[model samples]
Target chain A: MSAISIQQIVKTFPGKHSVVALDHVDLLVESGELFGIIGPDGAGKTTLFRIIATLLLADEGTATLRGMDVVRDYKKIRKVIGYMPGKFSLYQDLTVEENIQFFATLFLTSLEENYDLIKDIYVQLEPFKDRKAGKLSGGMKQKLALCCALIHRPDVLLLDEPTTGVDPVSRKEFWEMLGRLKTSGMTIVVSTPYMDEAVLCDRIALMQTGKILQTDTPQGIIDSYALQLLAIGGDHLYDTLQLLRHFEGTANCFAFGDKLHLSLKDNSYSAASVTAYLEKNGRTDTTVEPIQPGIEDCFMAYL
Target chain B: MRVLLFLLVKEFQQIFRNPAIIRIIFIMPAVQLLVLPLAADYEVKNVYITVVDNDHSSYSHALVNKLVASDYFVLTGYADSYAQAMLDIEQDRSDLIIEIPGQFERTLVREDKATVSIAANAVNGAKGGIGASYAASLIQDFNTDIRTDWLQLPRYNPYPVIAITGSNWYNLHMRYDLFMVPGILVILLTMVGSFLASINIVYEKEVGTIEQINVSPIRKYQFILGKLIPFWIIGFVVLTIGLVISRVAYGIIPEGSFGLIYLFAAVYLLAFLGIGLLLSTYADTQQQAMFISFFLMMIFILMGGLYTSIDSMPEWAQVIAHLNPVTYFIEVMRMVVMKGSTFADIRSQFFIISGMAVFFNVWAVLNYRKRN
Candidate 1:
């Protein structure tokens, strides 16, 4: 059974200059799968999460979770979905325990009923239970927010950039926790701008400018890049890029970190011939080698 | 219902966890109820006066002496001329100025009526009226005394239609403190409950907590009720404290049924909390909510007959006062406390408050968005 099925979803904000936040976006998540939406800022990842969480209505699409429509069955949908927003949005003035209890009671449950699910996270906050939420550290606040979201034992979890401002160590810990949550057969849909985190997800959708460019396994997307790639770097990186653009057998030349990845227009040019040609042009110490494509390489290729 | 209880508990924890906000929510209301009533009084006393005795005669001196003898006026200093007296008035050193024209006793004996010019500061119209009346009465008494003994004229009471009938109601002693204490209590409750509740919710919206709650399983009505019930109870508790202090310190107590008063108070508190929720739906920041609530509170209290009787206002203002909830609350409170009114007597006010509560709560729920 599909945990979440979104078909041709479209959302637009109205004003003098209307913004089309999402455009014909379609996605499907199998039951008990951890799916990630990988995109930069303003890539409509947050909009899609909000719609699936039943907090917003789409303009021209139908989205269902476990055969329940997001709009018509919002009350029932709210009971089974845990949503952590991009920002830390708990009551700042209330204590950590108080915020948790408030949200627990909001779902007609108690702390004792959900203690097992949140015990690991809540124990870290127990020492500072009496302290105001505003006085907590960033990582501790993130944990508290997660506890509040998961207090009801939700069947599906939707997190919008949960690790945006957290530290590196905390980000690693958060992903480990998500891995543990996946073992319990909870379907999770997470959005992130970090490309490194994309490897942890079972599947990911690479989005850009309100459109999904590709949706596949991390390895699958990397393997699908069809180009003859070569990394060229020397003393003159910018001049090498200009020289490569003018080269007779070059299709596309773009910089990637210390080296530039260049695609060939046709497979006629040899590596030694290109190197000797650069040396004759007073460009020495230049190295040329074929390289395997990664996700970042694939991203640059599409751009 | 269970969610409402949780929200109320959370609100209490939020308020109690911060000492500064606790002081503001609890102690400030007590101070306003106990201390501010004494400080804010309209009854003028010990008004400073400057006298310009231009006549330099016994009659002029005696008139100045009489004016100074009255407890209402204090002779601050003697001015050299009317211009100096006017200067004193402008400088706020004196509230009243007395100028005695050069009229010896012989002139009053011959002319039968001597003129005395008095200038009063009319910026505060009530103080000016009282000062002018007191001065005029003193002069009239002096004229009567002269006519009876020194002039050797017929023993007659000049301006003899002196009919004195005094009446007092609600507050028999007409203590300014009694009149002001309840009004200040009303203002304090309005600030702490309605204004504070609205501002608190708006602050959540500004900081993005409302979005969090929107995504949760909490219904819109449950969330609003949760935010409101806690503040409503706090407002009631604060009002009770104010009442106890008024009774202990000022010896004031309600002569009517306590249950009836609380019923009215509960309805009134619901109206106020509803208003706070409505304001929260319209505002996006704590500062905007506070400013708007303060503005509305000022308008309501001013028209509430807390400071002045609304009946004395113009027809238009009186009509507006009927729409103000504070006005009806103050009226009901005074009636029950001072006149021993019952629920039947205040049923009209009760209906108005209930109507306002229902109307505002429904409007607030409608305006409050689950998605934004």
Candidate 2:
């Protein structure tokens, strides 16, 4: 059985005009699996996580964690789930040690009882354990928040965009920590807007406008993009792109870094033929190469 | 219950670790309780006066002697004219002036009653009134003495049949501090618990820390309770310190049970914590929270009878005071401390505070939205 099963969940907020934050969203997380929700800002990632965490009730549909209904068994689910929110939500006035100990105590446990589970991250905060949580550096505060979330030895961990504002090094370190936690047979569901981080997850769901567009393994999604893609570059790249759009059999072309990534209806067109055509149209120093579709490419294809 | 205990401990740690908060929580109360009361008294003393004795007779000298004999007034300067006395009044060097007419003793002998003019500055109305009354009484006493000596009759004491037996309960001297200390402690506790609690939580929301706690398994109630319990305890500790200072500095002790006072304080603290929670739900920034709480606190304290008697206010205001938890707490505290009332004596106030606590908690929990 899946550790978490969300079936056609829907939530709407009442206002002058109703805001449809979640619409018929469904997800399933297997035990001991690392799942990721990939989307940009306002994509309902946090809303979905909150509903599953039992922090909010879905306006429609059923969500269950380990066979316990989110709404009916909220108190029971609270004990088994560890959630780290998108923002740093620890008590600012409390010290680092105080924050962790408070969370542990809330769960009817002590820090010593679950020290082994969080010791790796908690140890780094030992020097500044007495400092107010508000005064800690961003990275230290992040670590402390994660430690507090994990201090209760929860079964399912829900991290809502945990690395949104941290430095790259801290971001990388945080993922590594998640990986270590995953090996301990804990189910992890994380959300992020960074496509690069999508590759680190065992599986990912691409979401947009409160709807899940696709859910699959990162490689599976990329492998499923059947169109031939080519990276094209030349002088007057803008002019080249305009000319390429008018070319026969051209499907789609958009700027990708320093090169233009193009999808074509036919693969029979030769690179020399494209270069000759660009040169004929007053372009120079053009280069073209065939490239494999990445997760970003797959995301663009869906968009 | 375990969660509450953990949260309380965490709060104590936060309050105790910071030296600034420690100073505010512990030392500030002592200063307010000890020093502010002594400075706040309205009892008048050490009055200064300038005498323009036009007669310069033994009779005028005798009247001046009577005035100087009283501790209330001291002869500061001898003014040559009314203009000089006006200078003394403007400079605050003297509060009163006595102008004795020429031939004062001869006029009194012929007219039976001679007019002695007295001018006083009435800027501080209460003080001015007291000083004027003292001067009038002194002159009247002298006139009566002269009448008695001239007539060769025993002194006629008016109101001889009337007797006043004065007794000050709880506070024998009615030290202003005794009346003020408990009220000050109540205000401090409300400021620390409600004002600070709301600011702490709302600050997290403003800084985006609330999002972190929201995603955690920590329930919303747990988070709020965790934030409030520490402040509540700190407020109580501050109250205890204030109480000790009142005892040491003002020699005022509770006439009622100390345990009962603390019990009422705990209920009042919970109501205050609920108010803080409700404020957190409404505010998004610390400054906004502080200002809003400060405004509401002002209203609560004004109607709470911290400075004035609520009974003296309009009936509508008295009804509003019934809804104010601070009002009941202050009333209950004063009764226990000053009147030495037992539990049964304050049951009505206890019921009102208990009802308010329940109402505030429900309101706080209901108004607190998890998703926004």
Candidate 3:
């Protein structure tokens, strides 16, 4: 059996226009596996996490954690799953140690009982234990929130965009902490908008506009691209993007950093042929070469 | 029970940490209790009077002295004509006018009949009516004095008289602060209990900490109780401070038992705090909570019979006053403090408040949903 299973879940927010937040979303994760939900803002990632956390009821379908139904067995589910929301939800007026102890007492356990589970992250937050949660830096606040959520040592952990605003060094340290937690046999499910973090997960679901475009391992998602790709580098990049969009037999072209990744319908056109064509169009400075695709390249391909 | 204890600890810590809340809780009652009773006095004094003495006899001079001596009236000055006195009334300088008719002493000596015309500016109805009554009673005293002197001459017979005497009950001397202080204490207790409890939960919602609590395993009743007990205790502290101020400042001690007051206050706090928590459940922000609480409190306090007598209100307004929880507590405070009413006297108020506590708390608990 899977650690988490969601079937045909649909949620809509009633308003003047009535936004459909999730549309027939289905997913599954095996035990002890690190799953990632990769999407941009407003892509229903938070909505999905809220449903599994039992804080929301789906309009249509069912979700379960380890075979317990979300709505029917919510009381049981709440005891076994640790959910950290996207917003900083701990009491800001409380000190870091008080915030953690408060949650521990609510869960009917003390910090000394589950010290081993949160030891790795709590050590990083020890220096600021007496400081108010609101007074800490952005990264320290997230770390304290994580420690509060992990104090009970639940089997399933759901983190919603935990690293959205952290500095680069803290973001790296947070992932390493999660990596250690995962090896202890906890089923960790996380979400992020950064494509680079998606590579660290065991499996990822690519989502956009309340729908999942693809779900697979990082290597498998990259290998599924069937078109020949080329990178075009030159001065006047915006002009080059426009020129490549209008070029004959060009199937897709997207700006990726300094280079433009382009795909062609006909494989017969080589890098030398494309460069010769650009030179003929009064473009003096240009270079073209074939290259491999990354996860963002696959996401843009799907879009 | 342990969960409730922890929750209470967190609530007390947060409440004491905020300087603004500390000031509101401890200092506001002292300032308002000291200032409001002094300012809210209803005894009418210093009514400006303009006398038009057309009769320049010794009798007229005596009447002017009598009117000026009464504390209720301040003589603006004597006007030569009634028309000139009317000018003072028009300019808002004088509130009442007494016109002494011509031949005032001659008529009283011969036919024993005299008339003095009094015209008052009735724009301020209370001041005008009370001033006119005061002037009329003083003149009656002077007439009796002259008739007594005539009776001593043995020419005029003294008529048989029947005098009516009355006594003021519950508040002798008719001190207004005695009436106002107890009522103001009720208002202060209600504001502290209901307003603070209403805003407490909504602040958590606005800051998104409610979502964390909702996702936890805490039951709905436990959460609502945790929010309720702290303010419930604070309500008693405010009531105690108010009682002390009334005693030390105005020399007031409750004629009834202290146990009865606390018994009534304990149930009253539950009912009002339940109302506040009910409002918190329906509101998403502290501003929304405050506005809803304000709207209800305006109706509650105004119709609560603190500023005006409930018996004097229109029948429809009387129904609203009876329905207000604040009205019952204010009445209980007055009955216990002023009238020395015992437990048997306030039996109905006690049961009604208990019912309201159950009604509002049940509604609040049912309305506070853990999942949405």
Q: Each candidate: what lDDT?
A: 0.85, 0.84, 0.90
Please report, as a residue range, the 10-residue window in candidate 3 chain B with the lowest summed lDDT: B150-159
lDDT of 2 by residue, A1-303 (tens): 899998999999889998898999988888999999999898899899889877778899999999999888877888888888887778787788878877777677889999888888988899999898889988888899889889989999999999988899999999999999998899999999999999999999999878998999999999888888889976678878999998786777888888998887666775666767777877778888888988888887766
User: Per-candidate TM vs. native?
Assistant: 0.91, 0.79, 0.95
Clashing residue pairs found in predicted model 3:
none
lDDT of 3 by residue, A154-253 (tens): 8899999999999999999989988999999999999999999999999999988878888999998989987778998889988888888888868899
Question: Model 2: how far is B55 from its true place, Å?
Answer: 9.0
Error of 2 at B342 (Å): 4.3
Every candidate's chain B TM-score: 0.90, 0.86, 0.95
Model 2 pairs in collision: A88-B209, A89-B209, A89-B213
Give me the displacement of residue A195 in model 3, in angstroms: 1.8
**Sort order, DockQ high to low:** 3, 1, 2
Model 3 off-target regions past 4 Å?
A265-277, B55-57, B78-91, B99-119, B142-157
